[model samples]
Target: MNNADLRQVVHANSGTTCQELAEMFSVSHETIRLHLHQLGKTWKLSKWSHMN
Candidate 1:
């Protein structure tokens, strides 16, 4: 997905988990984390029970 689209989705669903995002985009969670980082967003894995 393009950066703009990802950014829009992230902003629209600020509370969504990385896994959910990965699944939505048909990518890996790590890829979502990298994209989020590039978009100046930080994801706290500790916030999600399944991630920990």
Candidate 2:
């Protein structure tokens, strides 16, 4: 997916951890984290402990 779509996905799932998001997007967890960090939404990507 494109960056915009990725951003939307992340925004839509507030409590999802990077790992979960990565799984959903078929990408690596670190890639998801990096994308969010680049998008300035690292705060939106929940830490592992906060994931449901």
Residue-level lDDT tens digits of model 2 in 1-52: 5579777775666677777788888999888877776676645333322222
Worst 10 residues of 2 by lDDT: 43-52
Look at candidate 1 and give me any clashing residue pairs: none
Tell me the tens digit of each residue's lDDT in model 1 across 1-52: 7768777887776778889888988999899888877777875653322122
List CA RMSD, all candidates: 5.7, 5.6
The estimated TM-scores of all candidates read 0.77, 0.69
The lDDT values for all models are 0.74, 0.67
lDDT of 1: 0.74
